[model samples]
Target: MDTCCAKALVTGKVQGVGFRRAAQEQALKAGITGHAINLADGRVEVLMCGERTAVKRLAEWLRTGPGAARVTHVEFEVIEAHAPDDFHTG
Candidate 1:
């Protein structure tokens, strides 16, 4: 399968709501490799690289996030693929 990368900034009520952890779980399940982290401005940033379909699926999931998260917006960019060894949370 062809690989791809997605970079997204998830906004609104995302922090302190286990958003990153949930994203990591979702990514792993989808066979994505990258990281999810809390930004200083109270948003969650995610980088996912893997199969094109898997990455796209993960990006869609980011739109809603975990049940605890009130995802108001998701800004995403498609980039050149660079696969990581594993998914991570930071």
Candidate 2:
């Protein structure tokens, strides 16, 4: 399958709201590989690597994360990186 990598900076009430974990679950369900990590600037950095469609789908989801997340904005960009074997959260 054709695969690629993408990065997103999620902002607004994402931290401490199970955003990373939720993202991990979503990524795993989609068969995507990457990670969701917290930034000191209060933004969640999500890297998705997999089929283009799946990556885009995950990016869209970041717009409105878990019920507890008040996702105000999600900045996305295409990137190049090695895909990991599984999804992760940090």
Candidate 3:
């Protein structure tokens, strides 16, 4: 149960499409913590911290996003874990 963090940039039809909210919900369901925010460059930034498996699952989900999201690409980097109390949308 190694804990870890992931920073992901999700692109394509992500803004104004419930992507952040959906990401929050998914993170909660996966028992992960962090935030999802819309970037100015038409991308969504997601930071997730949790068990390695859960974080990986969340990253996989980011590739598809909510049904309305076009999700052209998802780029991610492994980071030091932050262990936030809850998931949020920004």
Cα-based TM-score, every candidate? 0.88, 0.86, 0.87
Compare candidates 1 and 2 on TM-score and give the better one. 1
Query: Please, what are the lDDT tens digits per residue for candidate 2 over residues 25-74?
Result: 99999999989999999999999999889888988999999999999888
Clashing pairs in 3: none
Those runs of model 2 whose alpha carbons end farther than 4 Å from true positions after fitting are 81-90
RMSD of each: 8.3, 8.4, 8.4
Q: Could you tally the backbone clashes for each prediction?
A: 0, 0, 0
Rank ordering of all candidates by TM-score, starting from the highest: 1, 3, 2
Against the true structure, whose lDDT is highest? 2
Model 1 weakest 10-residue run by lDDT: 78-87
- Per-residue lDDT of 1-90 in model 1, one digit per residue for the tens? 899888999999999998999999999999999999999999989999999989988999999999999999999998875557797899
By lDDT: ranked, best first:
2, 3, 1
Residue 13 accuracy (lDDT) in model 2: 100
Better structure of 2 and 3 per TM-score: 3
